[model samples]
Target: MSDPSTASIVSTPRAEQPTETVSPVGAPQGDRKEKPRGLLGDAWLDLRRKPLFWISALFILLFLLMAAFPQLFTSGDAVNGSLDRSLGKPSGDAWFGYDFQGRDVYARVIYGARASIVVSVLSVLGTLLVGGAMGVIAGYRGGWVDAVLSRVADVFFGLPFVLGAIVILTTFNGSGTSNSQWKIMGLVTVSLIVLSWPVVMRLMRSSVLSTKEADYIVAARALGAGTGRIVLKHLLPNCLAPLLVYGTIMVGSFIGAEATLSFLGVGLKSPVVSWGIMISESQSFIRVSPSLLFFPSLFLVLAVLSFVMLGEAVREALDPKLR
Candidate 1:
């Protein structure tokens, strides 16, 4: 019997104590909560602090610009028509001076970057495509498929890199084809790709083999994911870090290899305008004008050093073990 004034206060079911909105497993607790950057993002953050990274980056950018636009760097002609300034020392107007054939060494160095960049980039792309695919197949499929691929890779690995390059270049590019610039560069790029893909294949295969048994990968496989899904969506994203680092390093290696071949009289020949060719032509005149050997060699060394430094920086940033 409640009093009429109280109006029989029906207990309001205790207003069900407000429950914490059941958040998703990893949902942020508050508006100020921060998200983590993944491997690449974190690596980039780490790389930004390194002077070596920026120095290498600047040099690489300089070379890339030099390659993409030689005209912008200098107003003078790359090749001179006369030997009037032959073996001329580097000066104000003629920065790198004239070569034995009266060519502007400065302009030639600028233009030469194009051929090296083109060949290296093309060869790297080709190597990664061929090697990465084979590696993925070998690691994921395993068993007979893995065994067959491994044996093939071993065969290539057993072959000497320099010797293999010589044979391939000589066979593909005969004496008559020396003047054919594109043909020679193409053969060199192809030979490099053929010889280098095995390394990438082994690298990627090992990465995949270690990662395939991981929890996420196992979960993906346990679910309805197909082979293509697992590889394209899961495997590649995780495994490409090593390839990126290696590819950066390999660019320098290939550049050196191309120059070596040219110095040996089989790479980019006369009239093509590459740093290698410049070195090759200047060797005999080392005593006459050391500048001829000095300038091109300097540029080549800078380019190679830049790439190698960049690769090392990236490796340090990406590899937790380094930290």
Candidate 2:
């Protein structure tokens, strides 16, 4: 008995018809506007506009490529050497010249990137896993837990980086030889992690403490979200900016630290072929072949500065106040 006009309007609720209704409120069907980007997306937009970021990014990419594929750049073997050519200066056949051991300096430098990058990168990653987790737990569940963890972090953090590494690495004195090179490297990496994670833990804990009291977080908790869910879903994203900046800078720091340790004869020993090892070996020959000291040190500085610059750019981009 319905009127014809009314009948047409009420035709049917077919499955296909509901698709249009599912669009966001006030939005037109099949004519969606772009959704607003989140923090990282906004960060990317800001980073793109900064020349420093691009420059540092290019250097990092080249370093990474060198690390991943050293063979692509040179057919020369890093370990192969001739004592007759020892301390030879840079020439057409040997760009970086020869080391005291008579090995091609250029080849060693290229191959050295793997160890230096691996140790520094892995140490920071492990720090993140250990420190970031502990921080989340402390910040989310305060009182006794926070007090204990904070105290522990303070104790380790009290030691200077170089001093602490020397103390911890002292256990492996004269141990990393040809057969056990990788093993010693692994232990060195672990030692670095133990020494360095406290800072990251403190940073994450403070960040979480600042963010947990926000209205949205309180609302999420009030709605019956569990601790893990709240920590992972809300607290982490909001609190990650400082940690990221510090981590980037720390990578460069660790690189220099590793080099220092090697220079002191306590890091990345023989057969490891790192920039640190190269520098360590070259220090003795500086009077005879300054190129030995120069090339590796140049690369080391470049690598460290690249990471530091990248961190600076990231900090400027991520912090709205800084921007």
Which model scores highest in TM-score? 1
Determine which window of 10 residues in candidate 1 has minimal summed lDDT. 8-17
What is the Cα-based lDDT of residue 57 in candidate 1? 98
All models, RMSD in angstroms: 5.5, 7.0
Once fitted onto the true fold, the runs of candidate 1 whose alpha carbons sit more than 4 angstroms away are 1-31, 176-179
Candidate 1 lDDT by residue in tens digits, 67-129: 998788987777554688778888997887888778788888888899988898899999999
lDDT of 2 by residue, 202-221 (tens): 88999999999999999999
Question: Candidate 1 at 230: error in angstroms?
Answer: 0.6
TM-score to native of every candidate shown = 0.89, 0.88
The global Cα lDDT (0 to 1) of model 2 is 0.88
- Scored against the true structure, residue 43 in model 2 reaches a CA lDDT of 94
